[model samples]
Target: MAIINCPFCNKKASDKSAVCGNCGGKLGEMSVEELDRLQRDKRLALGQSLNNHAMMSLIIFLGSFAWYYYREPETDSLEMYAIHGAMLVGCAWYLVTKVRLVLYKRK
Candidate 1:
């Protein structure tokens, strides 16, 4: 088989190989159109995930606050505090992922 450059790692690999030796990335099996379609689908999935995460973050933040104000007891329980903390963490994670996605697009 011919030697081909690995798309993921930029290393030389055999075209016969199913995966890149350097990075273990899938390789050389897909047609050009199939590869393009796969990449398009992957990007679309990522964008959908980002949107879902952002919406979930916003919903959690707003819902937690609304619950705290309207339904929580006069003195907050440990569970309520934990819920808020978890929401904050989730929101932070979503924001960080969003930033990473933006940086990846720039590259």
Candidate 2:
């Protein structure tokens, strides 16, 4: 049997086993073709998430601008306040989501 390095722990293992005996890490179980497929999926998911974040920011910016312009001549102080409040909430939500994703991935 050919010896190969484990992808997870970098330990050497025979190609015949499904996992590395040294670290119990799965090795050579996923074919190169499967790894490529998973990588493509990950890239697509990341791209979609990034696009979603950009869209959210754009929406928030446009909403704030519209709120400011619409109430500028009406002498309504609440409009600007509402715009800033909404923007703050949206930013907080985005940050929380980002932090959660990072923490979850660490495990």
Candidate 3:
């Protein structure tokens, strides 16, 4: 049997399954409109999750910025390097997530 993503819960299930293993949703009996609605809901949920991640990344970036300014870490020091790394990673992650959201919206 082939494994496939369930339209109801986006979980792995057998292509031969009549019901989804994760969500216990009837797979074979669902109508086209129902499947379309479920897919849209899944897309929306993913977008919202991505937005939450973007918000968290922004918060991390801001926190790191504030910490760096407050401490005034010495140049070439471990603390300075760590703070810079965090700031860079957080900013990059936020930007990537935003871009992904945009791409997803276009779909």
Candidate 4:
């Protein structure tokens, strides 16, 4: 008899319906605590993904740094430039991901 937003997917659905049409999420009666738990689960999953990405970036940076030092290429050679660029990009990516994760956690 009423249109309500699906708690799991935020899609419009009939309150009488058994499940969300868009995401097939269960439409059974849910308490406020359950909704909060679902939201928290989503946030934690995203945070975990970001954390993994940050770690990968750090690994990439370390690998590039080690390669640069090991090769000891000429200062202006293409290989040296490439390795340096990769190191910078990895550092920047890690920092940005960490900042985003912090902001998301604050929210």
Candidate 5:
């Protein structure tokens, strides 16, 4: 294995390690250009995920309002249905966003 200086602590380390053993800073396995590309891709993915969450939230809010205003005095079927649907959608959106964030953080 090739010897290289650790980016974190400036200690000697093997090129194969994914992170600096001394101070735990990342030592990328890929070439500089490849690492840059990966970072860009990650950023784009995060942006897309955030956008999806925002859109879902907006949809749920509007649906809730519509359901509330459309309710009749004697019947609440429509309102209940809309609320249930919105709750399900909101939960799904929350779970997906959380998972994406967790995966990105691990990488």
Candidate 6:
């Protein structure tokens, strides 16, 4: 195994090791370009995660509105309508955010 300096602790580390022995930080035989690409990929993944969360929130709000709509003894109440309207607004917000993030990823 080739010996290299650990980026985290500057200690001698073997290229074959997955982590630094001293600082327990990730140690890999990666070039500068590869490292930058890895970081970029991570940021993209984070953006994707945000999109997922937004979609989930939208689904939850829509489902709740559906459940409230179909419940038995449907008495027309202003409060019920208000609550459903709020849920719809929440769903719209999340949907917009998810779409924006997805479009941003394409660019």
Which of the two, 5 or 6, has more TM-score? 6
Candidate 2 wrong stretches, greater than 4 Å: 1-28, 73-78, 87-107
TM-score of each: 0.61, 0.49, 0.75, 0.70, 0.46, 0.48
The sequence of per-residue lDDT tens digits that candidate 2 reaches over residues 1-107 is 87766655556778678877999976557886664565566656766785677568657766777777776734456766788787777676667666655754564
Q: Model 4 RMSD to the real structure?
A: 3.5
* Sort by lDDT, top down from the best: 3, 4, 6, 1, 5, 2
Residue-level lDDT tens digits of model 5 in 1-107: 78866644657867777876888877766565664465577667777877688677767767666666676324456657767678677767767776776776676
- Of 4 and 5, the candidate ahead on lDDT is 4
Model 6 is weakest, by summed lDDT over 10 consecutive residues, at: 71-80
How many clashes would you count in candidate 2? 0
| Per-residue lDDT of model 3, residues 10-55, tens digit only | 8887767789989998977875577668877888889899999999
In terms of TM-score, the best-performing candidate is 3
What do the candidate models score in CA lDDT, each in turn?
0.72, 0.67, 0.88, 0.85, 0.68, 0.72
TM-score result, candidate 6: 0.48
Worst 10 residues of 5 by lDDT: 71-80
lDDT of 4 by residue, 1-107 (tens): 88876777877878777778999987766654775677678778889999999999999899999998888889888998899899999999999999998898788
lDDT over C-alpha atoms for residue 34 of model 6: 61
The per-candidate count of clashes, in order, stands at 0, 0, 0, 0, 0, 0
Over 4 Å off, model 6: 1-23, 26-28, 72-107
lDDT of 4: 0.85
Clashing pairs in 6: none
